[model samples]
Target chain A: MAEYPDRLKDTLADFNFVTTRSERAELLIDIAGRFEPVPARIATRPYAEEYRVPACESDAYVWSERQPDGTLKFHFAVENPQGLSAQAMAVILDETLSGAPLEQVATVSPDIVLRIFGSEISMGKGQGLMEMVRTVQRHARSTLAEQAS
Target chain B: MPDRSSETLDLAQRGYAHPDVLVSTQWVADHLNDPDVRIIESNEDPLLYASGHLPGAVEVDWAHDLNNPLRRDYLDQREFEQLMSRLGATPQTTLVFYGDKNNWWATYAFWVFQLFGHDRARIMDGGRNKWHAEGRPLTREVPQYKPTRYKALPRDDRHIRAFRDQVYQHVQVNLPLVDVRSPEEYRGERLHMPDYPNEGALRGGHIPGAVNVPWSRAVNPDGSFKSASELRRIYESEQKLSPDDEIITYCRIGERSSHTWFVLKYLLGYDRVRNYDGSWTEWGNLVNVPIER
Candidate 1:
């Protein structure tokens, strides 16, 4: 089996110790405060429909650029101002998966949403966040496929 | 032209049966420091309140605060009292609820509060989105209030709530049941939508004899509810439902239906409307329950 990205593993370790919902919410909210949307050079307003994440009510969009070392850097835009969870998720995916080896990034499971957000999340929210992780994995897989071809 | 100065005055002209239950954003702003009022933000997103919320507002999470930790039921009377106490709210405190998704979860919280007979509650007319659009102040600073000694009545599921057996009986008698989900969900097509995941139902479709009235029809684009006459056209004229009818509303998990329940019982002055909180998730999974596509 491919190994998980080291940064993702470290992030999960940090969440593992969250004993209360308020503690976890504070941490995720702080992470969301650091979220930066995709720069204009990559994409802009009225983002292309092709980049939109499916089933995401938050109206989130994603893009990837190849780094100098063949790794991928992910960028995201969450259109809904109240979509704080999506913002936090965008930040986590970009910080941990960007510049990591494609294989390792692809191995990151969607189940990590449960670990990070906890089981109390609504069903629709849980599904939407998982879809975000899947979208990032799809980008990494497609990049690896292009390299192989 | 409508008066733009105060939402409360504007709401009065809309002619809802119980317009006082809905307060405008401006009204809430003015009441921010009113010691008798407690502003509560409830949303489907757990992180929304933590990110930034209305100044002096407290969060009441649907999962962590309302639900019974062990069972699928809601918190009991003791639990309700504890929750109110934690919020520093006595029976006299007026709770004004608002949240994202056009107050979908806010109404759900309001419904749960009703189960405990908290009648002093009001829903912010336009919810969190409208507040944000108006550039209302949002702060990350969490407020701490001295806990109050709150007294709560035993939960009254008999009035505004319905269980599966009652729903089955309602169907048997051919009473009105409004399915407040999307058209696709009402038609059992949500399960097969390309690239979309199932919404946790073993089967698809709605309860037998239900009419599809998608809940959003009650609200305008700005997230404020449509006027009483407009809503009457949808529910009474188009759907042919009567204010005298004993209606039961349900959605995937009863969240959306609570929105409709609020509309019928309060806005249109329907005398008997109950929300089936178990909704499709429970009914669709039950072995012998009847579901119609």
Candidate 2:
């Protein structure tokens, strides 16, 4: 059994192999550049606040749902478009885990979060990135809890 | 009190200590075509500049650019020269810096430039936040230009930056220092700023004898610096800091402190001011450091 979502696994594989600081910087810039503007309806206060990325200094939000197919999808935005710290995490999770199955989402261990974002930022700030991934996984698990009852 | 008119005038009209350091958005809009002026956006988030920046502005990441790859310190003179050249900036070019967080990293960039002794730098007052609020233009197109043969002066930290050891000594002697983090962080209630995740600090609280003056107090809601008189009320009257005292400012990281550093050094013309970049993360993590609530 594949321990990771195919999409998340592929994206992780794509980033996991990058070995240089300069390359990591470029990859982050590439992700930051691809801002698909969230519509106002989605970015409104109550909607955004409910799923906000925890502990981010920037005003960041995320909406996650488990599809009928038992996969997870993510939507996220930060009020400060220039807040790279929050954006880097948002971009990584949205790109990797969107529509990922529960098992694969579970496979997104905190270590993997550390692995993905640790080198990109400094290890000193790795705790926040770890929590960010955990937040996403937390949202994914809620769906399982919903179905359990 | 002979000149009543002079007293009534605001700091902008009466002029700042270094009036040229702040350029207005309208001024930047007018000089959009001036080749001699280079707009640089040094945001805390590199992606912000990539999303949309002012026309012809270059992006510089404080972490990737200013910081040395293998060391804890900033880049040396040779690396700084290359960075300036790559950004299409000549020594004579007027580099205007702006970014998110009300020009916090903008002034951080300015302070780093000062560390390298680059004197031709100015900050775009109000930063990107104010610019966006005003409904100004932002473009996703990142600009490129021919590299200049840049010359970097000798690195100078003597007048501006402070290390943790100096902080310890200052604490013992009870020299003037300002703990510019939030009251909670200063009071040992939290290790990080409110709503910000903890950044790997081992312990909390601040250097003994350091006064808690939150950095946010220096700015207006729109993110511009308050008038000089109002600033005096904060630093001179409230905080009881003299203009000539050797003062050190700090926050969780160095960026927030740099904003206060700029205000003291340039806006109010304080003679001796330094930013303790080692700050809370460094202070809180280190072993055997005395901390106060």
Candidate 3:
């Protein structure tokens, strides 16, 4: 059993309405369109190794912060803006999990991506998506660990 | 990288069976304003064209244009005609294709065009990488053109395409089969290309009696095909394959094999070369299929 964020649940609900490959592709492309670079002030910093998503091939960077309200905030950036699948995954995860509680962020099982993309996504990209989730979760876990310390 | 673009290979002098099938980046740059020429950037990464492409070029999503909207095969004649008309291409229009990964997808698009009997289509040698490596200009602005009235030739799957049945018969007869994938993939060591993620095929290795001649062997590190004589030596002399032998090339998803198919049919003037589009993705998943480690 897993607990998901409210927004994530709604997003999944919205995606569930997509029953065809075109619909899923349209959803992904729409979400990918929303991914853009973070502000230069933050982008210029030495992107910490812990913030980087390993083996993404597009060089994605992520960071998470624990707000005073005990919710998580995520910042993400990637080198290849035209990487639709990878960028879409980043945007989708950030949208679903940012401002979400640590527990909700941790609840994003790998299968959610499979449910949304189905078999339409290629195996390489599927691996890339899992790697992305792990990277974001790594950041979220660090944020929790830092707050606890 | 050569600083002077003139040092680039003189493609017209290559003496290929279809020499006009290739055009240099300089030629593409020179023809930017030509009304008769249409530049179409076809890439494996569907979104790559959005980053930047050659000036006045339009992007074609191969899966969107080439695939049958409702079925598992490529678009029918009517759909292809509609697509051509929508893209402002007429029967007489000359289409030049270029993209990332050398010209893997470019050649694939060319193969699809050939399948539909569009003989005027051409490949931009070295593709986007070569064009960009030489510091040619890339524009973010996608051009808009008036759509034209176009009619496509009836789709012909024969002569160029090989189906599972044909491949099985070829294997039974022990006809030449070129496994145009990475060495690891050919040897059953990897399910897919070393860099490509595995797609969960139940079996590993290649079709029995297939010879390993990695597609990259036909191409240079910079993503350009080698000279015609060199290519002939590699395929005919080195591999001990004859130009007249009936040949079939296959890869995981058929894109890389299409490239080898291009080199054999057009570059080396091999008359009986065909691309098994289903390739390993279909062969590896089937039950009771003969696979050699």
Candidate 4:
């Protein structure tokens, strides 16, 4: 089992825009808590083999391990793993609140999408959805940068 | 205090998707057989269709779909109308577009549809990458076409475009041409569309009257769009984009511009948005066109 890192724990703690650390921990545990030990499958079409994107020598990334309750949890080494963009975090909150599938959330609508951590969240379709998460991280970093400046 | 607070409370128009935007690969697959739904693969790569694509998807190459070699970036309404005619698209067709890297071209095409006054368009979330990853069926065989009699809606010329002539006509006018490309591309450090390389590229700089708001800044890492309200707050409050200001977006070859175009026109309800389709590719190549950095 991969151990959760200390920095991630602290960052998760510091995200008081959503809730306190214990509350965040409780949310993570609740969402991913019910897992049974399932075999882990690391399935990815090698970009070099399929798509021809140049391979990096040291391309390290997060991986998920199946828990005893059959759910998958991700772990990160460089930064916070459970640290989602406010939008992504919102999708989870919406799914939890409305009992709708994650697939049902729309990323560009004016509807009152459920808020997680005081951020209204929505989902975009396809790989472009990553743009939404990046937007949040950029906002956070820009906010930090602005404050520093 | 009342005036400022009233301004805060007032929203120009709450723009959004009719049925909300995100749709899973499974949901798309389930509706793959719908007669009213047409799946378009808007890829930069030519072989996207040859390799394999959604069973009934018609191929749309961004380079080919938008322009000929003569005018690569911009598509005049007549040209755009003809392209729509060839695709058998009517004003009423509910275009469900998907692209290889999520929905870059799909979103671009969605913007094109809106420019042409077709509102019934949606992007397939996760795109073909997610669809194929989920063990969904793909076929290399091109589906036989039963061409429908689709007619073009008259171009809403006011909403569709802004030509160099128009910009030149208003050269002294202080309109903001917002370049949504990366800082490198906007500064002319990067060539437009590395695939179709061109020489005589702008040495290094941007439009004097332009602002750099990289499109990638508006997205999440998981390939979804940010919420509209947050997006509004970011672009409006943070970036200080006035609601009434006229904004034009451009990129290397106009693909990325369409992403911002979607955000501005459809997402934020900025109705005065115009895409400078010629972008750098056209503007940079013209011998007499003014060059900036």
Candidate 5:
């Protein structure tokens, strides 16, 4: 009997790999797991970042604002684009939210998911990383507007 | 009484409308007239600094200011203090730094400023190219500056520094070394420092068992860095880096390494990272040190 399935599962489980492998294996796993199989892994956006110019370059990316919950918001920029990774960016936000208890910061999200304050912001093809950034920005803007009102 | 207290602006407190990584040329141009603000042109090339630089800016050579000639890494405290005093920096003075070569030296200076406990320091975005392109003022003549009592207390313990000996220890332990150099240089295709001695230097290649990350890979086309989440993915996912392990970053000279160093320390929040300032210049020059093509 071929142990290929077991080998593929083991390979897919290793989080330490720099480049994620086992795409074919993942597809197989997805097919087996779902009742109805669908092409879900396909990426909609060719380029990971959508904007021709990053929002950080423009004046629109203002630093100081008040969240709807009446907390301070601050921005930090890096000279090199690579320095500000999604996970690293989350760490900064986590640090900034220190003024409020981690619990309070999470009250905006589900109690279970919000319990972890420093969760990584996703940034992949289609509505992955970009979608996450939009959610964070939307919440931030709404909070600021509410505070102002 | 004129209120000098309120006049003491905390640049950090305002949160730099730009973000933590970049400071705009417009902001720098607007504040050029502020008497308290001093700009320093930190360039690896003497000719570039000599030909043109921001008006009223002092020139600091990257090879000299940020490294030790004898040891090939971060400068000793005594030399660092002397350099700060020479730059007319006081404990109270706010220093704005930039460079000719894509803000490499400027980033190194930024690291030095933070290492020496100067919180009011920033790097000019897009550096000299942006400043000059936007028609900001520049002067060829070196402006004379009166020496000031610039108190420097190097936070050595807090800073991420590794001597030659420390790096050797890591190698012995099979630790990962990230070389932020061009692929050519890492693959033994590039050679020689721009202006430094070449007598004893090796022909080409990078440190043994090192990974080439290329410092330029970190920036976008306009020279601005990628977003925080983006940067984190690149380093963590692509580079396969763990937050717990020690990371040693190096380049041809120390300038690019320092830029990466700033990213690893302040941006990625890596606790155990260090810039091998001696980098290829000193490492390649050494007789018996291991090299990999």
Candidate 6:
């Protein structure tokens, strides 16, 4: 079994203590408040369709830039202003998986969406968030494959 | 291209049969502190209410607050009374519902409330998008209200809701059924999109003898409902549906169908309209159910 990223494990642990719905929502809203979109240095308006996350109603776009240490940094843009959940997911993916080892990042389970967002998340929303996680994993896996080639 | 804002007609001018069932954003803003009115925000995204919502608005999560925790059915009469008490509302209190996705979940919550005979409800037209676009105030402050002692009647599913058996019967009779899903979903094209999950259905396509009318067609680009004439053109003139037709609407799990149900029942004044809450998730997965691609 592949090990999960340390930061992601720690983040999930923090979410574990959130016993109440409001408390969990507050924590996620605080994270969503800190969301920063992909900067112009990486990409700009009219983003390439290839970067768009499938099944995401929020119209989210994902980008990964490789750092000097060979780690990938994930960035996201949620086009819908009301997509607070997508924003929080983006922030969490970037903060926890950006500098993590590609192998560990690639193995991150999308089920962590249920863990972090709670089980009550809607089917459409759960799928979209999971797809966001998958998009990030796809980037990591692609980078690894490219290096191996 | 016509300016969307210019194209928007006032609620009164839209010619809906029951214009009172819809309140404008301005009306909601004006009624923010009305003791008789309660603003409820329901959304698919759980974080939206806490992030920011209409001032003094309460959150009623559809899955958590409305649904029965143990079963697929909704909460019982006791549970409905408890929820109303928690919301600090009474039978006389008017609930004005609005939320994300152009009030898809809002209309859904409204539909559930109706099952309990809570008819003192109205949908905030254009929902959160129009409110935010118009720079209306939103707050993160969750309000505290004294819990009211409320009583609710037994849920009346016979009138507004449709079961799978009822849907099958409706199909057998060749009555009008509107499938308010995307064209791809109606055509069974989205069942196997690469890397995309199936939307909780084993089979694709729509119910037999159902017409395809994506729910979004009832609303404008700004999220507000289109004029009655425009809607009439779509449903009556285009689809050949009559105002007196008994209709049933369904989508993936009944949320989107509720939106269409609202339009046909209230906007077009259809005589009898029922929302099949089981929708495609139940029908598509059912054994030996008729499915048309």
Candidate 2 local lDDT, residue B26: 79
lDDT of each: 0.90, 0.77, 0.79, 0.53, 0.56, 0.91
Query: What DockQ was computed for model 3?
Result: 0.19
Model 1 regions lying over 4 Å from their true place: B1-9, B192-199
The digit string of per-residue lDDT tens for model 6 on B132-239 reads 999989998999888999999989999899999999999999999999999999998875333334347788999999999999898888889888888888998989
Across A5-82, the per-residue lDDT of candidate 5 in tens digits comes to 232234234322423222322332333232221112422223234222133321112132344556544332223222
Which residue ranges in model 3 land beyond 4 Å of their true spot? A5-107, A110-127, A134-149, B1-8, B12-17, B140-142, B192-200, B229-238
Tens digit per residue, CA lDDT, model 6, A18-75: 9999999999999998999999999999999999999999999999999999999898
- Report the C-alpha lDDT of model 1 over A84-119, residue by residue, as the tens digit: 899999999999999999998887888899899997
In model 6, which residue pairs have backbone atoms overlapping below 3 Å?
Answer: none
Candidates ranked by TM-score, best first?
A: 6, 1, 2, 3, 4, 5
Question: Model 4 Cα displacement at A21 (Å)?
Answer: 56
> Which predicted model would earn the best DockQ?
6
Alpha carbon deviation, residue B58, candidate 2 (Å): 2.3
Number of the top-ranking candidate, with TM-score as the measure: 6
- Tell me the TM-score of each prediction against the true structure: 0.94, 0.83, 0.76, 0.57, 0.56, 0.96
CAPRI-wise, candidate 2 is acceptable
Model 4's DockQ? 0.02
Judged by DockQ cut-offs, the docking class of candidate 3 is incorrect
The candidate, 3 or 6, that scores higher on DockQ is 6
Per-residue CA lDDT of model 3 for B173-272, tens digit only, reads 9999999877877888876424333345667899988888888787776667787777777888878889889999999878889999999998888999
Predicted structure 5: lDDT: 0.56
Kindly provide the TM-score of model 6 when superposed on the true structure, using C-alpha atoms. 0.96
Candidate 5 lDDT, B1-293, residue by residue in tens: 43222112232332222355456677778777676778888764333565557888887765556656666356767777787778777777778888855687788888766666777787776688767767777776677667776667755634465667777777778788889877877888756323223322555787777788888666555554545455566777888876686988887656689888776666567778888766777787777877889
Q: B-chain TM-score, every candidate? A: 0.94, 0.92, 0.93, 0.78, 0.79, 0.95
Model 6: how far is A22 from its true place, Å? 1.0
